[model samples]
Target: MNLFPINAGNLKLDGGAMFGVVPKSLWQKTNPADANNMIDIATRCLLIEDGNRLILIDNGMGDKQSEKFFSYYHLWGNHTLDGSLKAHGFHRDDITDVFLTHLHFDHCGGSVQWNTNKTGYEPAFKNAHFWSNKDHWLWATQPNRREKASFLKENIIPLEESGQLKFTSLPENDLQNNSELGFDIFFASGHTDKQMIPLVKYKGKTIAFMADLLPTAGHLPLPYIMGYDTRPLLTLNEKEKFLNLAADNNYYLFLEHDANNEIITVKKTEKGVRLDTVYTTEEIFN
Candidate 1:
Protein backbone atom coordinates (compact mmCIF):
# COMPACT_ATOMS: atom_id res chain seq x y z
CA MET A 1 0.00 0.00 0.00
CA ASN A 2 1.21 3.51 -0.85
CA LEU A 3 0.08 6.69 0.86
CA PHE A 4 0.09 10.12 -0.80
CA PRO A 5 -0.67 13.52 0.67
CA ILE A 6 -3.03 15.26 -1.73
CA ASN A 7 -3.25 19.00 -1.35
CA ALA A 8 -6.70 19.99 -2.48
CA GLY A 9 -6.20 23.63 -1.51
CA ASN A 10 -5.56 26.06 1.33
CA LEU A 11 -7.58 28.80 2.95
CA LYS A 12 -7.67 31.06 6.01
CA LEU A 13 -10.17 30.88 8.83
CA ASP A 14 -10.80 32.93 11.93
CA GLY A 15 -8.37 31.81 14.62
CA GLY A 16 -10.96 32.34 17.30
CA ALA A 17 -13.42 29.99 15.60
CA MET A 18 -10.75 27.39 14.99
CA PHE A 19 -9.52 27.36 18.60
CA GLY A 20 -12.90 27.87 20.27
CA VAL A 21 -12.73 29.41 23.73
CA VAL A 22 -8.96 29.02 23.90
CA PRO A 23 -7.35 32.45 24.22
CA LYS A 24 -5.51 33.70 21.14
CA SER A 25 -2.59 34.60 23.38
CA LEU A 26 -1.82 30.87 23.76
CA TRP A 27 -2.96 29.56 20.36
CA GLN A 28 -1.00 32.18 18.44
CA LYS A 29 2.21 30.74 19.85
CA THR A 30 1.59 27.62 17.73
CA ASN A 31 -0.85 28.83 15.06
CA PRO A 32 -0.02 32.47 14.76
CA ALA A 33 -2.80 34.55 13.28
CA ASP A 34 -2.44 37.26 10.65
CA ALA A 35 -3.32 40.93 11.11
CA ASN A 36 -6.90 40.00 10.22
CA ASN A 37 -6.85 37.32 12.91
CA MET A 38 -7.14 34.58 10.25
CA ILE A 39 -4.91 31.54 10.39
CA ASP A 40 -3.66 29.25 7.62
CA ILE A 41 -5.77 26.16 6.98
CA ALA A 42 -5.11 23.33 4.56
CA THR A 43 -7.46 20.92 2.88
CA ARG A 44 -4.85 18.18 2.99
CA CYS A 45 -6.62 14.99 1.91
CA LEU A 46 -5.06 11.56 1.90
CA LEU A 47 -4.82 9.19 -1.05
CA ILE A 48 -4.57 5.46 -0.30
CA GLU A 49 -3.31 3.38 -3.19
CA ASP A 50 -3.77 -0.31 -2.39
CA GLY A 51 -3.76 -2.67 -5.34
CA ASN A 52 -6.29 -1.37 -7.91
CA ARG A 53 -8.35 0.60 -5.43
CA LEU A 54 -7.44 4.29 -5.23
CA ILE A 55 -9.21 5.69 -2.18
CA LEU A 56 -9.23 9.45 -1.45
CA ILE A 57 -10.09 10.68 2.03
CA ASP A 58 -11.85 14.05 2.12
CA ASN A 59 -11.60 16.22 -1.01
CA GLY A 60 -11.41 19.96 -0.24
CA MET A 61 -13.84 22.68 -1.21
CA GLY A 62 -14.23 22.55 -4.99
CA ASP A 63 -14.06 25.62 -7.23
CA LYS A 64 -17.70 25.45 -8.14
CA GLN A 65 -18.87 27.85 -5.48
CA SER A 66 -19.35 31.49 -6.45
CA GLU A 67 -16.61 34.02 -5.68
CA LYS A 68 -18.94 35.77 -3.30
CA PHE A 69 -19.58 32.51 -1.49
CA PHE A 70 -15.89 31.67 -1.24
CA SER A 71 -14.88 35.14 -0.09
CA TYR A 72 -16.18 34.28 3.37
CA TYR A 73 -13.54 31.57 3.87
CA HIS A 74 -10.69 33.53 2.17
CA LEU A 75 -9.53 30.64 -0.03
CA TRP A 76 -5.93 30.93 -1.21
CA GLY A 77 -3.19 28.74 -2.69
CA ASN A 78 -2.13 27.18 -5.99
CA HIS A 79 -2.98 23.59 -5.06
CA THR A 80 -5.92 22.35 -7.08
CA LEU A 81 -7.38 18.88 -6.51
CA ASP A 82 -6.98 17.89 -10.16
CA GLY A 83 -3.45 19.27 -10.20
CA SER A 84 -2.55 17.27 -7.10
CA LEU A 85 -3.94 14.04 -8.60
CA LYS A 86 -2.05 14.65 -11.84
CA ALA A 87 1.14 15.14 -9.87
CA HIS A 88 0.68 11.60 -8.51
CA GLY A 89 0.02 10.19 -12.01
CA PHE A 90 -3.69 9.89 -11.29
CA HIS A 91 -6.97 11.67 -11.88
CA ARG A 92 -10.38 11.97 -10.25
CA ASP A 93 -11.74 9.20 -12.50
CA ASP A 94 -9.13 6.81 -11.06
CA ILE A 95 -10.45 7.24 -7.53
CA THR A 96 -12.45 4.15 -6.64
CA ASP A 97 -13.55 5.43 -3.27
CA VAL A 98 -13.91 8.84 -1.57
CA PHE A 99 -13.94 8.30 2.19
CA LEU A 100 -15.39 11.46 3.70
CA THR A 101 -14.59 12.03 7.38
CA HIS A 102 -17.56 14.33 7.48
CA LEU A 103 -19.75 16.36 5.11
CA HIS A 104 -18.52 19.80 6.07
CA PHE A 105 -17.79 21.96 3.00
CA ASP A 106 -14.08 22.19 3.66
CA HIS A 107 -13.83 18.40 4.06
CA CYS A 108 -16.17 16.97 1.40
CA GLY A 109 -17.19 19.86 -0.82
CA GLY A 110 -15.02 18.66 -3.68
CA SER A 111 -16.92 15.37 -3.84
CA VAL A 112 -19.33 17.00 -6.26
CA GLN A 113 -18.90 19.62 -8.94
CA TRP A 114 -20.74 21.54 -11.58
CA ASN A 115 -21.40 19.61 -14.78
CA THR A 116 -19.89 20.70 -18.09
CA ASN A 117 -23.11 22.30 -19.24
CA LYS A 118 -23.35 24.23 -15.94
CA THR A 119 -26.97 23.14 -15.86
CA GLY A 120 -26.74 21.13 -12.64
CA TYR A 121 -24.41 19.45 -10.16
CA GLU A 122 -22.81 16.00 -10.51
CA PRO A 123 -20.42 13.72 -8.66
CA ALA A 124 -16.92 15.12 -9.04
CA PHE A 125 -15.43 11.66 -9.18
CA LYS A 126 -17.93 9.99 -11.43
CA ASN A 127 -16.47 6.50 -11.01
CA ALA A 128 -15.86 6.70 -7.28
CA HIS A 129 -18.14 5.38 -4.57
CA PHE A 130 -18.47 8.30 -2.11
CA TRP A 131 -18.21 7.06 1.50
CA SER A 132 -19.89 8.47 4.62
CA ASN A 133 -21.47 6.76 7.60
CA LYS A 134 -25.27 6.55 7.77
CA ASP A 135 -25.48 8.73 10.86
CA HIS A 136 -23.29 11.49 9.41
CA TRP A 137 -25.10 11.30 6.10
CA LEU A 138 -28.40 11.98 7.83
CA TRP A 139 -26.94 14.58 10.15
CA ALA A 140 -25.47 16.52 7.25
CA THR A 141 -28.41 16.15 4.90
CA GLN A 142 -30.87 17.15 7.60
CA PRO A 143 -28.55 19.57 9.30
CA ASN A 144 -29.44 21.45 12.46
CA ARG A 145 -29.53 25.26 12.48
CA ARG A 146 -26.04 25.56 13.95
CA GLU A 147 -24.39 23.41 11.26
CA LYS A 148 -26.66 24.17 8.34
CA ALA A 149 -24.27 26.74 6.91
CA SER A 150 -21.40 24.29 6.75
CA PHE A 151 -23.39 21.54 5.00
CA LEU A 152 -24.13 22.97 1.60
CA LYS A 153 -26.59 21.13 -0.66
CA GLU A 154 -24.54 21.58 -3.84
CA ASN A 155 -21.54 20.01 -2.17
CA ILE A 156 -23.49 16.98 -0.87
CA ILE A 157 -26.76 16.15 -2.71
CA PRO A 158 -25.04 15.44 -6.01
CA LEU A 159 -23.16 12.42 -4.65
CA GLU A 160 -26.36 10.67 -3.61
CA GLU A 161 -28.19 11.90 -6.66
CA SER A 162 -25.48 10.47 -8.90
CA GLY A 163 -26.02 7.01 -7.34
CA GLN A 164 -22.42 6.84 -6.14
CA LEU A 165 -22.97 7.35 -2.42
CA LYS A 166 -22.26 4.53 0.07
CA PHE A 167 -22.47 4.40 3.86
CA THR A 168 -19.99 2.58 6.10
CA SER A 169 -21.54 0.39 8.76
CA LEU A 170 -21.13 1.81 12.25
CA PRO A 171 -19.65 -0.36 14.99
CA GLU A 172 -21.62 -1.13 18.16
CA ASN A 173 -19.23 1.13 20.02
CA ASP A 174 -17.25 4.25 19.10
CA LEU A 175 -14.27 2.37 17.70
CA GLN A 176 -14.58 -0.11 14.83
CA ASN A 177 -11.57 -2.42 14.74
CA ASN A 178 -12.18 -3.24 11.12
CA SER A 179 -14.27 -1.47 8.54
CA GLU A 180 -15.37 -2.34 5.05
CA LEU A 181 -12.79 0.19 3.84
CA GLY A 182 -10.04 -2.05 5.30
CA PHE A 183 -9.08 0.20 8.23
CA ASP A 184 -10.02 0.93 11.81
CA ILE A 185 -12.59 3.69 12.22
CA PHE A 186 -12.80 5.87 15.31
CA PHE A 187 -16.32 7.27 15.29
CA ALA A 188 -16.42 10.68 16.98
CA SER A 189 -19.66 12.61 17.48
CA GLY A 190 -18.58 15.58 19.54
CA HIS A 191 -17.46 17.54 16.48
CA THR A 192 -20.41 16.38 14.48
CA ASP A 193 -22.62 13.32 14.53
CA LYS A 194 -20.63 10.16 13.76
CA GLN A 195 -17.54 11.72 12.17
CA MET A 196 -15.54 8.65 11.04
CA ILE A 197 -11.80 9.01 11.68
CA PRO A 198 -9.98 6.34 9.64
CA LEU A 199 -6.95 4.68 11.19
CA VAL A 200 -4.87 3.44 8.26
CA LYS A 201 -2.05 0.97 8.75
CA TYR A 202 1.14 1.74 6.84
CA LYS A 203 4.87 1.16 7.34
CA GLY A 204 4.20 -0.74 10.60
CA LYS A 205 2.54 2.36 12.02
CA THR A 206 -1.05 3.47 12.46
CA ILE A 207 -1.86 6.88 10.88
CA ALA A 208 -4.97 8.34 12.44
CA PHE A 209 -6.62 10.86 10.09
CA MET A 210 -7.15 13.61 12.65
CA ALA A 211 -10.10 15.36 11.12
CA ASP A 212 -11.94 18.09 13.08
CA LEU A 213 -11.48 16.02 16.24
CA LEU A 214 -7.91 17.31 16.31
CA PRO A 215 -7.53 19.95 13.62
CA THR A 216 -3.97 20.99 14.42
CA ALA A 217 -1.04 20.61 16.81
CA GLY A 218 -2.38 23.58 18.75
CA HIS A 219 -5.54 21.59 19.35
CA LEU A 220 -3.61 18.89 21.25
CA PRO A 221 -4.64 20.53 24.49
CA LEU A 222 -7.91 19.08 25.78
CA PRO A 223 -9.43 22.51 26.31
CA TYR A 224 -8.51 23.79 22.82
CA ILE A 225 -11.77 22.66 21.25
CA MET A 226 -13.40 24.24 18.19
CA GLY A 227 -16.23 26.64 18.85
CA TYR A 228 -18.01 25.16 15.85
CA ASP A 229 -18.40 21.83 17.63
CA THR A 230 -22.00 21.28 18.66
CA ARG A 231 -21.12 19.75 22.01
CA PRO A 232 -17.90 21.20 23.40
CA LEU A 233 -18.13 19.23 26.68
CA LEU A 234 -18.47 15.96 24.81
CA THR A 235 -15.47 16.91 22.65
CA LEU A 236 -13.34 17.26 25.79
CA ASN A 237 -14.17 13.71 26.85
CA GLU A 238 -13.61 12.25 23.37
CA LYS A 239 -10.30 14.06 22.88
CA GLU A 240 -9.01 12.85 26.26
CA LYS A 241 -9.77 9.24 25.38
CA PHE A 242 -8.38 9.41 21.82
CA LEU A 243 -5.24 11.37 22.74
CA ASN A 244 -4.32 8.88 25.45
CA LEU A 245 -4.78 5.99 23.02
CA ALA A 246 -2.72 7.73 20.34
CA ALA A 247 0.07 8.46 22.82
CA ASP A 248 0.11 4.93 24.25
CA ASN A 249 0.10 3.26 20.84
CA ASN A 250 2.50 5.75 19.22
CA TYR A 251 0.16 6.49 16.34
CA TYR A 252 1.23 8.98 13.66
CA LEU A 253 -1.53 11.56 13.42
CA PHE A 254 -2.20 12.68 9.82
CA LEU A 255 -3.54 16.14 10.32
CA GLU A 256 -6.15 17.23 7.76
CA HIS A 257 -6.54 20.89 8.61
CA ASP A 258 -3.16 22.07 9.90
CA ALA A 259 -1.56 24.06 7.07
CA ASN A 260 1.91 23.91 8.56
CA ASN A 261 2.19 20.68 10.56
CA GLU A 262 1.58 17.70 8.30
CA ILE A 263 2.01 14.70 10.65
CA ILE A 264 2.78 14.41 14.35
CA THR A 265 2.98 12.01 17.31
CA VAL A 266 2.00 12.63 20.90
CA LYS A 267 3.51 11.59 24.23
CA LYS A 268 1.91 11.28 27.63
CA THR A 269 3.35 14.21 29.57
CA GLU A 270 2.64 15.44 33.06
CA LYS A 271 0.22 17.91 31.50
CA GLY A 272 -1.45 15.01 29.67
CA VAL A 273 -0.87 14.10 26.01
CA ARG A 274 1.28 16.67 24.19
CA LEU A 275 2.95 16.93 20.82
CA ASP A 276 6.07 14.79 20.72
CA THR A 277 7.44 15.23 17.18
CA VAL A 278 6.34 16.81 13.96
CA TYR A 279 6.98 15.29 10.52
CA THR A 280 6.34 16.23 6.96
CA THR A 281 4.52 13.81 4.68
CA GLU A 282 7.82 13.23 2.90
CA GLU A 283 9.66 12.35 6.13
CA ILE A 284 7.13 9.67 7.06
CA PHE A 285 5.63 8.46 3.75
CA ASN A 286 8.93 8.24 1.91
Candidate 2:
Protein backbone atom coordinates (compact mmCIF):
# COMPACT_ATOMS: atom_id res chain seq x y z
CA MET A 1 0.00 0.00 0.00
CA ASN A 2 1.11 3.60 -0.74
CA LEU A 3 0.14 6.63 1.31
CA PHE A 4 0.09 10.34 0.47
CA PRO A 5 -0.72 13.44 2.46
CA ILE A 6 -3.57 15.32 0.81
CA ASN A 7 -3.57 18.95 1.91
CA ALA A 8 -7.01 20.27 1.03
CA GLY A 9 -6.46 23.82 2.31
CA ASN A 10 -5.73 26.02 5.29
CA LEU A 11 -8.19 27.89 7.48
CA LYS A 12 -8.02 30.33 10.36
CA LEU A 13 -9.97 29.72 13.56
CA ASP A 14 -9.98 31.45 16.92
CA GLY A 15 -7.01 30.31 18.97
CA GLY A 16 -9.02 30.39 22.16
CA ALA A 17 -11.57 27.94 20.76
CA MET A 18 -8.91 25.63 19.35
CA PHE A 19 -6.88 25.60 22.56
CA GLY A 20 -9.90 25.49 24.90
CA VAL A 21 -9.19 26.76 28.43
CA VAL A 22 -5.41 26.55 27.93
CA PRO A 23 -3.91 29.99 28.54
CA LYS A 24 -2.68 31.91 25.51
CA SER A 25 0.87 32.16 26.87
CA LEU A 26 1.30 28.37 26.71
CA TRP A 27 -0.37 27.40 23.45
CA GLN A 28 0.76 30.52 21.62
CA LYS A 29 4.33 29.26 21.74
CA THR A 30 3.43 26.29 19.53
CA ASN A 31 0.40 27.64 17.64
CA PRO A 32 0.82 31.38 17.60
CA ALA A 33 -2.22 33.48 16.74
CA ASP A 34 -2.52 36.33 14.29
CA ALA A 35 -3.52 39.89 15.11
CA ASN A 36 -7.12 38.80 14.84
CA ASN A 37 -6.52 36.12 17.44
CA MET A 38 -6.96 33.37 14.81
CA ILE A 39 -4.58 30.46 14.29
CA ASP A 40 -3.71 28.62 11.07
CA ILE A 41 -5.57 25.30 10.61
CA ALA A 42 -5.04 22.68 7.95
CA THR A 43 -7.67 20.42 6.48
CA ARG A 44 -5.03 17.82 5.79
CA CYS A 45 -6.49 14.53 4.53
CA LEU A 46 -4.85 11.21 3.77
CA LEU A 47 -4.83 9.04 0.65
CA ILE A 48 -4.42 5.27 0.97
CA GLU A 49 -3.68 3.35 -2.21
CA ASP A 50 -3.83 -0.41 -1.77
CA GLY A 51 -4.30 -2.69 -4.74
CA ASN A 52 -6.84 -1.01 -7.04
CA ARG A 53 -8.63 0.80 -4.21
CA LEU A 54 -7.71 4.44 -3.59
CA ILE A 55 -9.21 5.58 -0.30
CA LEU A 56 -9.40 9.23 0.85
CA ILE A 57 -9.87 10.00 4.49
CA ASP A 58 -11.77 13.29 5.00
CA ASN A 59 -11.74 15.49 1.90
CA GLY A 60 -11.76 18.81 3.75
CA MET A 61 -14.23 21.68 3.24
CA GLY A 62 -15.11 22.02 -0.43
CA ASP A 63 -15.59 25.29 -2.33
CA LYS A 64 -19.36 25.24 -2.39
CA GLN A 65 -20.31 27.37 0.57
CA SER A 66 -21.49 30.91 0.14
CA GLU A 67 -19.00 33.78 0.35
CA LYS A 68 -20.58 35.01 3.57
CA PHE A 69 -20.40 31.55 5.07
CA PHE A 70 -16.71 31.22 4.15
CA SER A 71 -15.84 34.65 5.54
CA TYR A 72 -16.62 33.37 9.02
CA TYR A 73 -13.93 30.67 8.94
CA HIS A 74 -11.36 32.84 7.07
CA LEU A 75 -10.16 30.24 4.55
CA TRP A 76 -6.63 30.79 3.33
CA GLY A 77 -3.81 29.23 1.27
CA ASN A 78 -3.56 27.95 -2.31
CA HIS A 79 -3.73 24.25 -1.45
CA THR A 80 -6.87 22.56 -2.79
CA LEU A 81 -8.29 19.04 -2.90
CA ASP A 82 -7.91 18.67 -6.65
CA GLY A 83 -4.53 20.41 -6.79
CA SER A 84 -3.15 18.27 -3.97
CA LEU A 85 -4.36 15.07 -5.66
CA LYS A 86 -2.82 16.15 -8.96
CA ALA A 87 0.46 16.90 -7.23
CA HIS A 88 0.58 13.24 -6.19
CA GLY A 89 -0.39 12.04 -9.69
CA PHE A 90 -4.01 11.24 -8.74
CA HIS A 91 -7.39 12.78 -9.38
CA ARG A 92 -10.65 13.09 -7.48
CA ASP A 93 -12.36 10.42 -9.58
CA ASP A 94 -9.67 7.88 -8.80
CA ILE A 95 -10.72 7.69 -5.14
CA THR A 96 -12.55 4.41 -4.54
CA ASP A 97 -13.49 5.11 -0.94
CA VAL A 98 -13.91 8.25 1.19
CA PHE A 99 -13.58 7.33 4.87
CA LEU A 100 -14.96 10.21 6.84
CA THR A 101 -13.87 10.43 10.48
CA HIS A 102 -16.92 12.59 11.08
CA LEU A 103 -19.28 14.68 9.00
CA HIS A 104 -18.17 18.10 10.17
CA PHE A 105 -17.96 20.64 7.37
CA ASP A 106 -14.19 20.89 7.50
CA HIS A 107 -13.85 17.10 7.34
CA CYS A 108 -16.45 15.89 4.84
CA GLY A 109 -17.58 18.95 2.92
CA GLY A 110 -15.45 18.02 -0.04
CA SER A 111 -17.23 14.72 -0.44
CA VAL A 112 -19.89 16.43 -2.57
CA GLN A 113 -19.84 19.19 -5.13
CA TRP A 114 -22.06 21.32 -7.30
CA ASN A 115 -23.39 19.34 -10.22
CA THR A 116 -23.22 20.51 -13.79
CA ASN A 117 -25.71 23.31 -14.67
CA LYS A 118 -25.50 24.20 -10.96
CA THR A 119 -29.00 22.92 -10.30
CA GLY A 120 -28.04 20.59 -7.48
CA TYR A 121 -25.22 18.94 -5.59
CA GLU A 122 -23.66 15.55 -6.37
CA PRO A 123 -21.06 13.20 -4.98
CA ALA A 124 -17.65 14.71 -5.71
CA PHE A 125 -16.12 11.31 -6.34
CA LYS A 126 -18.73 9.70 -8.54
CA ASN A 127 -17.10 6.27 -8.35
CA ALA A 128 -16.19 6.32 -4.65
CA HIS A 129 -18.18 4.82 -1.80
CA PHE A 130 -18.49 7.43 0.96
CA TRP A 131 -18.00 5.75 4.32
CA SER A 132 -19.35 6.91 7.70
CA ASN A 133 -20.52 4.89 10.67
CA LYS A 134 -24.29 4.60 11.17
CA ASP A 135 -24.20 6.50 14.46
CA HIS A 136 -22.18 9.40 13.08
CA TRP A 137 -24.27 9.50 9.92
CA LEU A 138 -27.45 9.94 11.92
CA TRP A 139 -25.84 12.33 14.42
CA ALA A 140 -24.62 14.59 11.61
CA THR A 141 -27.78 14.51 9.52
CA GLN A 142 -30.07 15.01 12.52
CA PRO A 143 -27.67 17.30 14.30
CA ASN A 144 -28.34 18.78 17.71
CA ARG A 145 -28.20 22.54 18.32
CA ARG A 146 -24.65 22.33 19.65
CA GLU A 147 -23.26 20.84 16.42
CA LYS A 148 -25.80 21.88 13.81
CA ALA A 149 -23.63 24.58 12.38
CA SER A 150 -20.75 22.22 11.75
CA PHE A 151 -22.84 19.58 9.97
CA LEU A 152 -23.98 21.14 6.76
CA LYS A 153 -26.68 19.25 4.91
CA GLU A 154 -25.28 20.18 1.53
CA ASN A 155 -22.05 18.40 2.31
CA ILE A 156 -23.74 15.18 3.45
CA ILE A 157 -27.06 14.60 1.71
CA PRO A 158 -25.47 14.20 -1.68
CA LEU A 159 -23.65 11.04 -0.70
CA GLU A 160 -26.81 9.17 0.18
CA GLU A 161 -28.61 10.75 -2.71
CA SER A 162 -25.93 9.57 -5.10
CA GLY A 163 -26.29 5.99 -3.87
CA GLN A 164 -22.69 5.92 -2.67
CA LEU A 165 -23.14 6.14 1.08
CA LYS A 166 -22.19 3.05 3.15
CA PHE A 167 -22.11 2.55 6.90
CA THR A 168 -19.68 0.39 8.88
CA SER A 169 -21.42 -2.14 11.14
CA LEU A 170 -18.69 -2.82 13.69
CA PRO A 171 -19.78 -3.65 17.24
CA GLU A 172 -18.60 -1.18 19.88
CA ASN A 173 -15.96 -3.55 21.26
CA ASP A 174 -14.80 -4.60 17.81
CA LEU A 175 -13.59 -1.08 16.92
CA GLN A 176 -10.13 -1.65 18.37
CA ASN A 177 -9.24 -4.56 16.11
CA ASN A 178 -11.70 -4.35 13.23
CA SER A 179 -10.18 -3.67 9.83
CA GLU A 180 -12.22 -2.23 6.97
CA LEU A 181 -11.29 -0.66 3.66
CA GLY A 182 -7.67 -1.57 4.51
CA PHE A 183 -7.51 0.14 7.93
CA ASP A 184 -7.84 -0.93 11.54
CA ILE A 185 -10.71 1.16 12.94
CA PHE A 186 -11.11 2.69 16.38
CA PHE A 187 -14.01 4.80 17.54
CA ALA A 188 -14.08 7.82 19.88
CA SER A 189 -17.13 9.81 21.01
CA GLY A 190 -15.64 12.75 22.92
CA HIS A 191 -15.27 14.96 19.87
CA THR A 192 -18.40 13.73 18.12
CA ASP A 193 -20.55 10.67 18.17
CA LYS A 194 -18.73 7.58 16.93
CA GLN A 195 -15.80 9.33 15.28
CA MET A 196 -13.80 6.61 13.51
CA ILE A 197 -10.03 6.93 13.76
CA PRO A 198 -8.18 4.78 11.30
CA LEU A 199 -4.96 2.96 12.18
CA VAL A 200 -3.04 2.17 9.01
CA LYS A 201 -0.12 -0.25 9.06
CA TYR A 202 2.60 0.83 6.64
CA LYS A 203 6.37 0.58 6.40
CA GLY A 204 6.53 -1.50 9.59
CA LYS A 205 4.81 1.24 11.60
CA THR A 206 1.29 1.80 12.93
CA ILE A 207 0.20 5.29 11.89
CA ALA A 208 -2.73 6.63 13.90
CA PHE A 209 -4.79 9.30 12.17
CA MET A 210 -5.33 11.69 15.07
CA ALA A 211 -8.57 13.30 13.99
CA ASP A 212 -9.67 15.97 16.48
CA LEU A 213 -8.91 13.64 19.42
CA LEU A 214 -5.36 15.06 19.40
CA PRO A 215 -5.29 17.89 16.87
CA THR A 216 -1.69 18.94 17.37
CA ALA A 217 1.43 18.46 19.45
CA GLY A 218 0.25 21.23 21.77
CA HIS A 219 -2.75 19.06 22.65
CA LEU A 220 -0.48 16.27 23.94
CA PRO A 221 -0.77 17.64 27.50
CA LEU A 222 -3.92 16.10 29.02
CA PRO A 223 -5.86 19.30 29.63
CA TYR A 224 -5.26 20.93 26.25
CA ILE A 225 -8.49 19.86 24.58
CA MET A 226 -10.61 21.66 22.00
CA GLY A 227 -13.58 23.71 23.16
CA TYR A 228 -15.60 22.60 20.16
CA ASP A 229 -15.96 19.11 21.55
CA THR A 230 -19.45 18.39 22.89
CA ARG A 231 -18.23 16.61 26.00
CA PRO A 232 -14.94 17.98 27.26
CA LEU A 233 -14.59 15.68 30.28
CA LEU A 234 -15.12 12.63 28.12
CA THR A 235 -12.45 13.94 25.79
CA LEU A 236 -10.00 14.12 28.69
CA ASN A 237 -10.53 10.49 29.57
CA GLU A 238 -10.37 9.36 25.94
CA LYS A 239 -7.18 11.30 25.29
CA GLU A 240 -5.53 9.84 28.35
CA LYS A 241 -6.33 6.30 27.28
CA PHE A 242 -5.38 6.82 23.61
CA LEU A 243 -2.14 8.71 24.29
CA ASN A 244 -0.90 6.09 26.73
CA LEU A 245 -1.59 3.36 24.22
CA ALA A 246 0.02 5.38 21.42
CA ALA A 247 3.17 6.11 23.41
CA ASP A 248 3.45 2.53 24.68
CA ASN A 249 3.14 1.11 21.18
CA ASN A 250 5.29 3.75 19.46
CA TYR A 251 2.54 4.73 17.03
CA TYR A 252 3.23 7.61 14.65
CA LEU A 253 0.33 10.11 14.88
CA PHE A 254 -0.78 11.65 11.60
CA LEU A 255 -2.29 15.00 12.50
CA GLU A 256 -5.16 16.37 10.40
CA HIS A 257 -5.80 19.87 11.70
CA ASP A 258 -2.26 20.86 12.62
CA ALA A 259 -0.98 23.21 9.92
CA ASN A 260 2.69 23.26 10.83
CA ASN A 261 3.41 19.86 12.34
CA GLU A 262 2.58 16.93 10.08
CA ILE A 263 3.42 13.70 11.96
CA ILE A 264 4.34 13.35 15.66
CA THR A 265 5.30 10.51 17.98
CA VAL A 266 4.70 10.71 21.70
CA LYS A 267 6.90 9.36 24.45
CA LYS A 268 6.21 8.74 28.12
CA THR A 269 7.92 11.51 30.05
CA GLU A 270 8.14 12.73 33.64
CA LYS A 271 5.31 15.09 32.69
CA GLY A 272 3.35 12.21 31.15
CA VAL A 273 3.02 11.54 27.43
CA ARG A 274 4.66 14.27 25.38
CA LEU A 275 5.81 14.76 21.83
CA ASP A 276 9.06 12.96 20.96
CA THR A 277 9.71 13.95 17.33
CA VAL A 278 7.91 15.67 14.49
CA TYR A 279 8.20 14.70 10.82
CA THR A 280 6.62 15.85 7.60
CA THR A 281 4.46 13.33 5.75
CA GLU A 282 7.11 12.87 3.11
CA GLU A 283 9.75 12.11 5.70
CA ILE A 284 7.66 9.31 7.17
CA PHE A 285 5.75 7.98 4.15
CA ASN A 286 8.37 8.50 1.44
Find the candidate with the highest TM-score and give its number.
1
**Tens digit of per-residue lDDT, candidate 2, span 1-286:** 9999999999999999998999999999999999999999999999999999999999999998899988998988899999999999999989999999999999998988898989999998988999988888889989999999999999998898888999877554725564568778878888898888899999899999988998888889999989999988989988988899899999999999999999999999999999999999999999
lDDT of model 2 at residue 45?
95
RMSD of each: 0.8, 1.1
lDDT of 1 by residue, 1-286 (tens): 9999999999999999999988999999999999999999999999999988999999999889999988988888799899999999998999999999999999998998878999999898988999898888999999999999999999988888888989888889989976468899999999999998999999899999999999999999999999999999999999999999999999999999999999999999899999999999999999
TM-score of each: 0.98, 0.98
Model 2: colliding residue pairs: none
Q: After the best TM-score superposition of candidate 2, give how far the Cα of residue 238 lies from its true spot, in angstroms.
A: 0.8
Candidate 1 root-mean-square deviation in Å? 0.8
